[model samples]
Target: MLSPDKVSAHADEDWENAGAGDTIDVERLVAVVRRQWRIVAVCMGIFAILGLVYILTAVPKYTASTSVLIDRGNSQIANQMQASVAAALPIEDDASVLSEVELFKSDSIGLAVVDKLKLLDIPEFTSPARSPISMLRSLLNFRTWFASDDVAADDIDTLRHNAADKIVADMDVDRIGRSYALSISYTSTSPELASKIATSIAEAYLVDKLNSKYDATRRASEWLQERIDELKQKALDSDLAVQKFRTAHGLLSTGGQYQLLSDQQLSELTTQLIGAQADTARARAKYERVKSIIDNKRTDAIVTDVLDNSISNDLRKKYLEASKLEAEISARLGPDHVQAVRLRSEMAEYQRLMFEELNRIAESYQSELQVAQTREKSLQDSVTQASSVTAAAGETQVQLRELERTADTYRNLYQTFLARFQEATQQQSFPITDARIITRAQVPTAPSAPKKPLILALAMALGAAFGGAIGAFREYRDRFFRTGEQVRDVLSLEYIGHVPAIDAKEAGSGNKDPESVRGLQNGNGITNYVVNHPLSAFAETMRSAKIAVDMENTSTRCKVIGVISCLPGEGKSTIAVNLAQLLAMQGSRTLLIDADLRNPGATRAIGRHAEQGILEVLLEGRPLKDVLLLDNKTKLAFLPAVVKRRVPHSSDLLSSSIMVNMLDELKAHFDYIVLDLPPLGPVVDARAISPMLDASLAVIEWGRTSRRVVRTTFAVQPEVMQKCIGVVLNKVDTEKLKLYRSYGSGEYYYNRYSAYYHEA
Candidate 1:
């Protein structure tokens, strides 16, 4: 039984505060003891024997560990930015340590270590003294995996990988519960060897990291130097290209820069002057046309065309007027006359004026053209000055370009040189990494396995568990009982009494060779409750319960307590007789009634003569007093159930109130009565006989009555199922009780029973 206090204490010890879990898996050592006791026993036994074996014949290994602190001296190192310090130390980042870890696991590092130790060429370990288990392990080793092939590149790679893998495998690095420190440990049959291996691994890691940094920096310096040289050459070539371009172009000193600028200015002025001269000529022509338009209201088309053509517009106008006068004279005076002479003179004068005017205009036009040519000459001079200035400007531009090319070349070369120098100097310094050893493996004096105390304790507990398992299995699987409680619990009936399941030697009152009713038990008779303690509670309880039941109903009659079962051969007949005898011994007028009409058992078991009985009296309509059979020795009366092949509807006969009335009549004569009925499961005879009984009881064979079949048997009779008060479990083995007490059985209170139950 699990008590609240014990369970709570256990739960608290386990710190089980989780709200009741989805499923309670309380494997309280108790339940385990009750359930898997065998498994626990076996496991404990194995461990114990293993301990003993370890103590006796097993080799004891002593561990010797020495500690080391991988103090990556973080605080001791100087920071680069703090120039106030004497020396600026390189700060090592976490990445550096991780890198070292990876590199330490590299094949190059591992192979170097292996070569130094000469482990690579060590032939396969083929020792004759190897254990079978060890031999099996070696058989699956790498050498065997590739033993048949020639060494190849892939093989070499695998070898290197495995070598590195072995280093990690052999060395146990513990930073498990620690920080920034590695405690490396190695175990070997030789303590010194383990220490050496651990030390070597650590030293190898630091050295490898340092070498890698130095190599990387050295390579960078070499690359930078090469780049500097290449850049210098490129700068020189670019400078030469610019110089050649200048020489071919005839560009002199930068004085020509101004000359080219001056030429550009002159070209601009000349273009402007030419435009102005052309505009002046166009304006003069337009002015003459406007004057002509002013002088004459209408101007002829031919006059307009010839206005600026080496002739003045005024001359053309006078000539036109004279021509008009001559036409008038010719029209008025006929051929010759004095007036014609005067007009000719005037015409001559006009012609002369017109010629003079034409000459003047031609002169003026020529002058203007001459002036434009002069101005163009002046612009050419200005262009010449501008060309000089442009030359100076071009030369200055060339010099500026040359200077820029030189500066670019120098800067590029200087940058490459600086990079190379920095790399070389930094490489020369070879700054030590910031990482250092923190915690190292500690040497232990004892091994952690094969504890002896734990072994012995486990062994004792194992034995008890083994015994309990055997007992529990037997308790669940076995069938039958030989005690009163065993009978009452299964049948749910008040136990009349227990008549122990006896061996053939002490057997009495049962079938096989029970030849007589008088003094049936053999010599030195059976040591049964019947003979040993007649006044025991086992018998008294039966009498008391029967009395209580009868008194409650207040019916004093020969009502029968039917002793029935689901099937045959369950000691029911024997119980019926014993019960009647027990009642008789208690001075109750008891009658043992046998109602198994089809097959009579009482006539043989009791060895009583059954020449006249209940069957004969009932069917023949005879008086039942003549049918009463008395046990010759005990004061118990008996009613025999006759064996007859021709026994009519015996089930109906048993149920008829005629039978109830018959018992009612006999109740006046008898104090107690019992009926041994046929097995009620297969027949309805018991149900038919229910009215004839005041009370009833049934017996169950303990473990053999499976849950399924028990229900099957219980369903056989309605009255038997409904009226059954208690069950009787039979044939329990007592040996299991002792083991149970040691294993799963707890301390019980004896005071509860000590007052009432006296040991006999």
Candidate 2:
């Protein structure tokens, strides 16, 4: 069972191991950026300077703007006139405003401005119209005799087109929101020219509009005039034809109800026949009244005609006078008197006259009725004859009515044309435009280009981005080991400890003689380093290596520990020697063997001048004690290799049965035998003897050797890798590691516990 601390420690180690693969940590990236800040600053400064230079050298341009008010004028007038005929158009929207804006920037305006200002005469717009690249090519081809310097006609036209296109491109036309106003602007090097061009474009647009309206009015007037003349002639000819037709038929009446001659005769005869019929009816009624008076003897009942007659009234008066006379005479004489008889005779004569009058009146009525009947019959016959003639003339009347209708149409057309013609003439004389210039352009007071501050800020931002990229690249490019964690993680090996770099003055570990220490490289002979500086961080690191080796060994008696390196100058010998001495000081019988026949650094470090050591023992059967050097102070023993003969294959010699036998024999006497072998990179000596040793340890120079080299070596020799105990990250700069908080060993272990240790 493990404690919580132990379990946490194991988990943390596993986490760190997992993180050491291809995955990059954010903290490490930030650290790398911080470490390379000086480079980033330099790059930013350079970019800023370039921006400053451009801001100083860039050309300045002036912009001029003109405002135009565009009303729905012409469209309104057109709509009013064509209301009944034309389709109703939608009110102007954003698209209509944009169309106007495009018109303001169109080539027509450009051409007009060019002509008005004589832009072709100006060098700015016309000279060197060909692009610089094209001109350069033409110049380059000038050495050939047949190379034409004359521009083609089409090319000249194209150049002019490009110039016009440039003018349009430089002009900006923007509608002010939804309002009917446009802001037209142009940019140029010359302020006055820019202003002039802006103003001219606005004026030109107005003139073009007026011209369009005038043309439309002229067309309408011409069409109306021609139509009016044709209508007047047609009306005159129709009226004359109608008059001629009336004269020929003798039916001349100006009103529509008037009839032809035959129709009038028929109407008069019919009226006469109706009068005759009324007379005949009255006469018959009178005759019937007389008959009733005579047959029924009702003399007192008078006829209506007699009552209405003046002669009958007079006759009735006379009869009454006579009867009065008769009565007087009878009273005077009896019967035979002459006077009385005359009176009676007068009365009787009056009565006879009254009867005769009544009879004559009746006869006169009868005769009048007969005459009326004869007249009615004749009139009836005449009416029938006239009706036949009128029917025959009905077709002619239809023809005449058609001619009258045609004449009315012509007259009406003439009146309409005349009215429209007058209107068109008035409009043509005074034309109106839809758009007018609201604000005239003026010469600009200040240049409007090459924004300096904005350019500088952008340059700085770009520089920072590029610098960060460079920093990231540098971090990825560095593939060497920097901490103990890297040795374990990158190479998948156990990490023992990391040895702090020894100062030059304290690094001569095995050189007991002052002269030998001075002669050593950086005075790095650290064979007695643990004994001399027991309390120092370097010595503590060596103790840590010893502990790791002890913990890794499972054998009961002895552990044959082989110290190897992937490359030379990695401090493997120093680590092995110091580790063995540290074990000896702890009362372990340890032997430090310098088994590297090639470049024996340990042999030289201990000041051993013996010409024969492991090589002589293995080849000549020399006893090991004869070449073994023992440290008297720490009682540590080491067998140093002396070069007695140059062997071609050192790895083969190290793998010999004799050397294995010697190592086996020594293993029984010592508690721990540490062998410092040659680096495994240039030769296979370590791999050759790895089977003979119990375990092997690799020494990697911190921040120096590449992890790939070590990992590849182990990969090639699986047996050696299996026998390998782990690695020690040697020659670490402890002070530098403290600054790099991202380094796992430094941040979590060394820096945290640095104050706990005291200096030797």
Candidate 3:
């Protein structure tokens, strides 16, 4: 029976392979780009050549510009002309200048330029211009040159319209700030034609302006002349009516104004009535004073004028003397004496005479006052009658004044129309415009298009971008492990080491050696590189892989390491042979078994006959040491297998109870046993004997093996994968390892230590 201790320990060392679960691996992607950078460089070079060809063959084009300055100098004409003429012209505002810009690009202006310069004959305006691409097309196809030329008369108009459109499209008019100036630029194949068209457009605009102003003034003159004649006739008829009305009313002017006859009589009577009223008042006052004195018997109290008469004054004096005499007589005689009586009689006679004189004076004053009052009343009645007659005549005077005002109004209107007619006639003879050309157009000297530097710069940038994108896409689609990290990340297995490719020189081949079927051939028949090149880095890396396998085993008994690969040519047997040699060189007893009955690579390398290998011991039930070959230099033993005699398949012999018992018996003699199994990718031999092994290691060809094939190896035969301990990335290219060093840790380590090993 197989040793239970070794069998159970090997079972425990088995681990899941990468394909046991899915995961994303990016390190392998970066390795693909680094490995295929040459392809990307080639693609970019091709694009650069194409760009150069296009730029060199492109046709050269020219453009020309001309400027015209619009100065509103004609605005000064408004100030020089009459006010009415100035009011009729358009004023220059911001809107007017912008309107002129639109007019400069107008179809009318474009058509005028086309007609003046006969631009329809130019091929660029009438049809599409010939470019480099179009010229190439015409050369390739003869049908393009024989295109139809027949068209209707309407097509000629259409052609002219199209030419006008092209002229307008190629021309640019720009206003200079807020000023009335323009920069007119035109693009064409000929510089002279562009400048000539620009100049003609400006001249056309000036002529159109002058004609517009002249027509407006002529229309105004004709309308005014008709209106003036009508106004003159109306004025004359109004003056004749005013004179006729004045004669019919029989009015006259006393001052500078006309007056009625009744109004004159009323004026004279008013003056006489005022004088008679004053005389009547004075007479009545004198009569009242005198009459009052006579009625009261106060003859002495009468006014001086009433008593100024001599007879009244003497009577008053005589009465005073008689009173004195009568008093003296009465004192001498008795109170009834005849002398006193006779004196009193004389005084009475004098008093009666004075009273009569005062009465006469009062009567004269009363009669004169009554006569003055009657005359004043009669004059007042006459004045009132004359004033009523004058009021009636005032109505006719108002009508006469209205007729005179109408005549004056008609005369003033006739004079104003006559003045306007004269001004309109003057405007017709000398018309003015609101805009004038300050500067004429001139030919330009340079083209303004097809910037070559910018085009080439963009072309080179695009080419590089396209090449990079293609490289990235190739990287994404690659399905292989190119770095040592892919062993761990993509395959989901532990990484043992990176083993550089061992060439014939490094393997130390000699003339006396036997040739091998497939391996690094060296003298002495496929010499173990680890043992021959002892101080080399490749030998050192094999030693490291031996240590890692040894660490995983950790058993005092025989440690069985099964070496396998996903594909047949991935160098698994070489790694196993070298690893066993390294372990034996360390003074440990090592056994290298060639268990691949189908393809015995190690059996052939050791120059041992295949019939005397493990199949003899297992099938014939022979002794354990009967088929073993020992090497003296490394102290390693090898049991090589021969495929000359075949059974049903390799798995039948590998999985048999005899094979297990054979491995168990050898465990007591060897410290480690390395099994070189057939590739797991193409056969089931590796999985069949997995349970009998301590641990398994995978060997991959760097940058050459497919990741999908390796994954399928573990996925289909999971039992073999469970016994796998780790992986070894073999046959690495050191220069490429340095380039893709950043892709994985194993590549970086290999690049750093590659110099330690010298190549012949």
Candidate 4:
């Protein structure tokens, strides 16, 4: 058995252990779900019903689908040819395909389909069902109130526009993978109408493409024709200007070859002058050679022109023969031979004849030289004249070249535009679109909306999620005592036991004896329950409280125990009365006192008919024996508080010297004294009388009282908390308590030990 100090130290150690850390407890979560399972079921059932209602009320719609392939292959030839003559069209890509998909959903296509299909005449388009917001506005008559009387309702144009908008709203368009294919789908109540609308939208898109291309080509052709005419006139004007400028500047070109006449004349004059200069140089050389041979009278010098003269060649041959004979005669004969003299005279005569012939040739060379010089001078004069005329023509050639280049550019442009004009004309006549129908829209066989099972499943899942959230909130706020573990962990006090609530009806139904029957009829069943059901859990809990009191005050002669609570209606008076009865039944002299002067619940339960009680004993000096009521079965004495009027100063009365002396005097007659005190939360009467108590028992309502309130109550009343031996969880519902059971707790094994208690 532990003393109060040792018990307190042990509680402190347990508190430290409990406060070490907070972690998730799976058992606690299971317990919470068990306690709130009904709420979850109710929420799930409501959501399921709503889902079913929606499914039953929803209108089913049929969907029709059509596929359009963007056939770039069909336009490849035209695009390639057009690219050579103009800016190339952009190549088809993912972005271009997606753009085509968007075009299928555009307002232009939608409006075209609406008009072509005469959708405004159909009931689904013209007189469609009103939306919830529109219905609400109609109910309020807001349009009539805000609009002018002159405003027309549902005009033809407005109806057509609305039909177009409705068509667009019901349509879905998307690209199919990376390929150049578009999928268009539409939904409506009628399968045939859905198919018709989808097909009409696709047809409208393709037709719109063809019409756009045709219009663009026609415009391009008209512009190209205008440009061709303008370029043709400009090319003709440039050609005429070039011809007129050339003729005015005397820069006429040679026929067939476009060379200027002045340049040809200069070229011919330069060639002839070169020939004349060569002839003059030859004639002058011949004349100089003949003159040198005649002036020096030398016969050794040779000239080609003189050599070609036959008379000069013969004379030179004869002179050579004679000189040879003269040399031989002079060598054979002495001083002056007649033959040598004769041969030398003959060589002289031959030299004279050759000189005469050379003179004649020189005269002819001089005449030829004069003629050649005259011809060279005449050609030089002609070349100088041609050079001056060519130089003048060269100066004027810059402007002529400019005019000629301008003419050539205009001519090329004219030809290019002429080709472009022809291509555009061809395109306008035979227009082609890039898109074609791959799969025509077909009527759907079945409705495509309002999946009942999926909706119901989703609704149930949402409901479960919502219910779980609420359950989590309830668990977060459930900070109250439920088991002995909570008492030990939260308040750090030994948990005595649970005092199960005994109803008046149940108490009377079990009892057959007159005394037990009388106690049940008077609402004193709970106070006398320990005596009637001695082997029951209620009686067993009272025995446990007694044991805790004994252990805490082992050395004390008189144990004055106070039964207190944090808040009102916690059944402290019942615990006090039952504990005292249990002590007296075990052959101990026990005295139960109703110490709460303001609300004497113990006196009302066991001593309600008493005339005077603790007030008389404390204020009027009445003897305790005179006001005490005796229980015949248990031999227990009770002191009840019979308040005739409101007692404002309840705490002052409990802490008074008269009350202390009265307790001290009663201690000599009683082995154990149990006081039913007011709650510590609202009043300080329990704390005021705490110093006189040997041990105190805190009575807390199971799962109803908050741990924070109880802790605050003890914190404010430190003396009461120090004297408190343990805590008792009162009014426990055994069935509900099972949900809060945890491992190692007293209630966890209650089912196994429940057979030991006999209530009937």
Predicted structure with the largest lDDT when compared to the true one: 4
Q: What is the lDDT of residue 531 in candidate 1?
A: 29
Q: Report how far off residue 416 is in candidate 1 (Å).
A: 12
Report how far residue 295 has shifted in candidate 2, in Å. 55
lDDT of 4 by residue, 1-760 (tens): 2356756777776775567447677777788889888778878888899889999998999999999987876687566655534432544677777677778767789889988988877988887478998777677986567776663655767887888889889999987877777899999989999999999999999899988888888899889989999999999999999888877766644665455777888889999999999999999998998898899988899888777888888998899999988898899894289999998899989988988888888899999999999999999999999989878877577777788899999999999998888788777655667778999999999987777889999988888877888877887898999888788767777788898877877765322234431221225477778888899999998999999888778898889999999999999988888899899999999998999999899888877667888888878999877888887667788888999988888889889999888888988988999999999988888888888999999999998999998987788888888888788899999998999997667788999999999887
lDDT tens per residue, model 2, 403-515? 77887888888887887787777666555566778899999989876778888998888788788778778667768887655665566666667788876566544444443
Off by over 4 Å in 1: 1-46, 62-115, 119-170, 176-179, 211-431, 437-528, 564-574, 593-630, 637-671, 677-691, 700-717, 729-760
Which candidate has the top score in TM-score? 4
What is the TM-score of each predicted model, taking all chains together?
A: 0.52, 0.60, 0.53, 0.71
lDDT (10s digit) by residue, model 1, range 221-284: 7777777777777777776765666565554455444223354466678787778668667656
- The lDDT values for all models are 0.57, 0.76, 0.73, 0.84
lDDT of 2 at 78: 54
Ranking of models by TM-score: 4, 2, 3, 1
Candidate 3 collision pairs: 509-522, 509-523, 510-523
Query: Following a full C-alpha superposition, what root-mean-square deviation does model 2 have from the true structure?
Result: 16.3
